[model samples]
Target: MDITGAAAVVTGGASGIGAATVRMLAARGAKVVVADLNEAAGVALAREVGGSFVKVDVTSTEDLVAAVDEAESLGPVRVLVNSAGIGWAQRTVGRDGRYASAADLDAFKRVVAINLVGTYDAIRLAATAMSRTEPLDTGERGAIVNLSSVAAFDGQIGQAAYSASKGGVVGMTLPVARDLAAIGVRVNTVAPGLVDTPIYGEGEASEAFKANLAQGVLFPKRLGGPSEIASMIVEAVTNSYLNAETIRVDGGIRMQPK
Candidate 1:
């Protein structure tokens, strides 16, 4: 919907793609709330953008609900970007030199809990608040943009847990859109491939790693930037007709099998 004067909440707004979206949203005149576990970065970004910051753990119902309430105080939450997530690179079968063993259950569960289930938790609650909101001019209540990864489609050698967690986000997009269609709320996902987020390294990725990730990219021949993904998210939220879809922001790269 209209970004101007709209209240928006962005989980994982401390840095990376979430931070980029928050900046873009603020520039468009949306009243934003930075929701993330990183207090210093979140608060600093909020200050820079003239928005509020809420320390949130996506897995906590209370935290997610509280963020929704915080945004409501600014205005009806008309824009939501669920960008909070954790990543792991663990093979399903562990190596013990002579033999392989099953993966660690806790590691797998942790990834799913935050990246998958946590997304659902935030969306379910935020949509509840959005449902009560009066529809905008285009009959839109709000829009939700969830983050997934290209790994969901083509995971690397040790990314089983990460892939499964993100794949769930991709899987639920259509159903979520259908479920919220009656309320005029749209749901969509963006699965980015090999983004240059902090996850890779603080500044520049190693030459070898960058080359490896960029192997199949058609033109750019480099890692996608956070701003690129953020732009897609903002565009999706503003465009009322786009719904129940997962857009791949990869540079035409189908990740190679590891």
Candidate 2:
């Protein structure tokens, strides 16, 4: 799909992969909307990319609608990147080996709510807006890219909640694409390995920790970069032939059981 003059909404656009995507899309001549809860970073990045910033909590439909409206105000909404997500770690049964110490139900639900439900909320709102636009020569109105994780498949210990949430994204890709096919909208997903993002802190200790984590990678012997993942996301959006697929940007790491 041609994105020139089109508008794109990127959740979690404040930093990491989302920020990289906003920059790339802007360079491609698409008007971008930085939709994120990080007001400061979102505003800064939007200004740098010559886009608009909308504070959005993905779990909130009202916030998502405002973001879609903001994108529409810029141009036709043709792209949406569901990059906003959160993670939590705890085995279904905790360290104490007792039901009372099992992973907090509230925590698990919160992770699924934010990572899975929030993603769908953004997709539905944006797809609705995209449906209203005129179709292009290829009969395509828009494309969507949702962020999953290697955990969705190669889930390790303590990843139950994160895996379930991301797995839902993978599970829904083809069906969601089929559902939106009638409207000429395509859905795809990108499941990344360990990408270097702010979630990892900086410092000698952090670097050493990350370096150790990199040992598991099949090749490139390092964590993935946000820009690397963003490149694939941009391709997913611009490549009209790619649809209903979940591409793993990881360097062939299958993740070990912890």
Candidate 3:
């Protein structure tokens, strides 16, 4: 599970948590492949890390397949990070008189497809490629770290779709880990609390929201840093004993209805 000189693929590597992960992996001597929908950002990030970029839409199987191929060509892909996901904040029925119609259902489906199905697709494809590689000293052929959210367990009022998708991810971790056991590949997830990622506004969150989030945190009464999540990911990958688990990197803050 040592990432040193290993080839790693990180989806949604253009910005936010994904970008932080890309940098962390690269710093650890992993030859990373940045897979993202943003071509320019992906390329720029890859260049900064001295890695490679593969433009990919995680919702498309073809795009994911191609990304895997490109990563494999670089070297053995021993690490896979699923960080690409979309968050939606619409109630099933809005007070503004917007009913949850066919279009709303379709939009929800799209979110699920991108966040859950897409993550599964990338994991399966990347794991298949990793299985073909020889095992390392730790008897580990590869490791996959999936990104989930605290909302999976503690959803806010308007986060139905986003929470459902993330909940699915949390549910899948154990079984996928069991399935990949024989191949020496480990699967795990990280459910983060409110982090200062782009998912929250570009800058700091609104004062009221920030205060609310920090209400019950044990320490650091503020949003988490992207590097904090990245650190856990690196640890999970490097520690072969860790598998089939979803660790919460939140500051002990379980969100509630505002």
Tell me each candidate's TM-score: 0.95, 0.98, 0.93
lDDT of 2 by residue, 1-258 (tens): 899999999999999999999999999999999999999999999999899999998888999999999999999999999999998888787676788998889999999999999999998999999999999999999999999999999999999999999999999999999999999999999999999997889999999999999999999999999999999999999999999999999999989997
lDDT of 1 by residue, 45-129 (tens): 9999999999999989999988999999998788889999988876666567434477777889999999999999999998999
Clashes of each: 0, 0, 0
> Candidate 2, overall lDDT?
0.95
Q: TM-score of model 3 relative to the true fold? A: 0.93
The best candidate by TM-score is: 2
Q: lDDT at 180 for candidate 3?
A: 97
Tens digits of lDDT, candidate 3, 80-119:
9999998888767756564543237877898899999999
Order of candidate numbers by lDDT, starting with the best? 2, 1, 3
- Alpha-carbon lDDT, every model: 0.91, 0.95, 0.89
- Comparing 1 and 2 by lDDT, which wins? 2
**Candidate 1 residue spans exceeding 4 A from truth:** 97-101, 202-208
Task: Sum up the clashes in candidate 1.
Answer: 0
Off by over 4 Å in 3: 96-103, 202-212
